[model samples]
Target chain A: NAGVIQTPRHKVTGKGQEATLWCEPISGHSAVFWYRQTIVQGLEFLTYFRNQAPIDDSGMPKERFSAQMPNQSHSTLKIQSTQPQDSAVYLCASSLAGQNTEVFFGKGTRLTVV
Target chain B: SQLAEENPWALSVHEGESVTVNCSYKTSITALQWYRQKSGEGPAQLILIRSNEREKRNGRLRATLDTSSQSSSLSITATRCEDTAVYFCATDSGQGGRALIFGTGTTVSVSP
Candidate 1:
């Protein structure tokens, strides 16, 4: 299996611009997760979806950040009016099930907001 | 506050040496996982120790969990240059087990 696939391994966007990161989960996996990693914050859980439905997004910033999972195969994380603070590696992961299962992660999309 | 925290922000060792990383977490958890992330790649699970499991081993890696103390540890033996990576401890807590809460991570550098 190719595991999880994240598109545009690296992205460069000007300040105030928008950035959209994409993730294609492994076949037959029912859960997908999004996380942000920076040198300062390490790995921070952003949101997650199960069975193509958002389960929890409590970690997401209340403003300018949103995520959606239209189907079991794919999910997206979008940042509006990006700021330099948003510059970090956006990681996507998937698992066969939500609990007690091993989760696989993609290489991650490096988003650089200049 | 982070649910989990790793001790010793960074560690370095030469080939064939052994190293251990420790992690402590708050609250109760069903399971604890240890992941390793190489440069430019996402983290991958190295070991998972459930609340009922006190120790688990895989190849040259060993993991110990003390649920009583809400802490866990990972040890790598006979390390090689390829063993260089950032190690993180994650917990599956009250979030419906949908996502893992990660620690600050310990960067392990193994030089040849």
Candidate 2:
């Protein structure tokens, strides 16, 4: 079902610039999640959406970071004034709305801030 | 510290050999899942062990859960080169709308 699709497999941006990552979740899935992966932090949770509504964003950076799911089909994560430390692979996952369901992930978008 | 964590940060093995990865969690959970992520790819689920069950098996993989100890382990037999990847253990609290908490991951390398 195309699983999950993340646009711009790789991205490079200058520090202090803005970068946006896009994710298209699996069809018919009601839950979508965003995560950042790095060697030091591994897979760190950033946020999630249920039925197009944000559920939790406790893992997200309170400043310079934001995520939105305008519809059930797609979501976006944006960073303002990106810094070198913000570079990492951003992963998107989706699953049916339920407890302990299998979550399918996309290949991820590698964001490199130079 | 992470809510879930894996030990033996990295390991190496030969084809046809076996290996085991262990994990420990700090909180109560309804299920523990094992995921493998290969180079340039996203993590894929290999096994899911529930709190009520002690062990679960899938093909050449076996997963064991110990609720009292808040630990779990994933064992792979007759490993292959394609088995090389980073394995992560994630815990699901079973709370409504809660996300699965992932571990740091253990890197496993299998050579021919």
lDDT of 1 at B28: 89
Q: Which stretches of candidate 2 lie over 4 Å from their true place?
A: B93-97
Residue-level error in angstroms, candidate 2, position A68: 0.5
TM values, all candidates: 0.97, 0.98
| Candidate 1 deviant stretches above 4 angstroms | B95-97
Residue pairs in clash, model 1 = none
Put down candidate 1 lDDT per residue, A1-114, tens digits, no spaces. 998999989999999999999999999999999999999988999998989988889889999999999888889999999999999999999998747689899999999998
lDDT of each: 0.93, 0.93
lDDT of 2 by residue, A5-99 (tens): 99989999999999999999999999999999999889998999999989988899999999999888899999999999999999999999887
In terms of docking quality, model 2 is medium
The lDDT of model 2 is 0.93
Please provide, for model 2 over B1-112, each residue's C-alpha lDDT reduced to its tens digit, 9 standing for 90 to 100: 7999999999999999999999999888888899999999989999988889999999999999999999999999999999999999998634554787799999999999
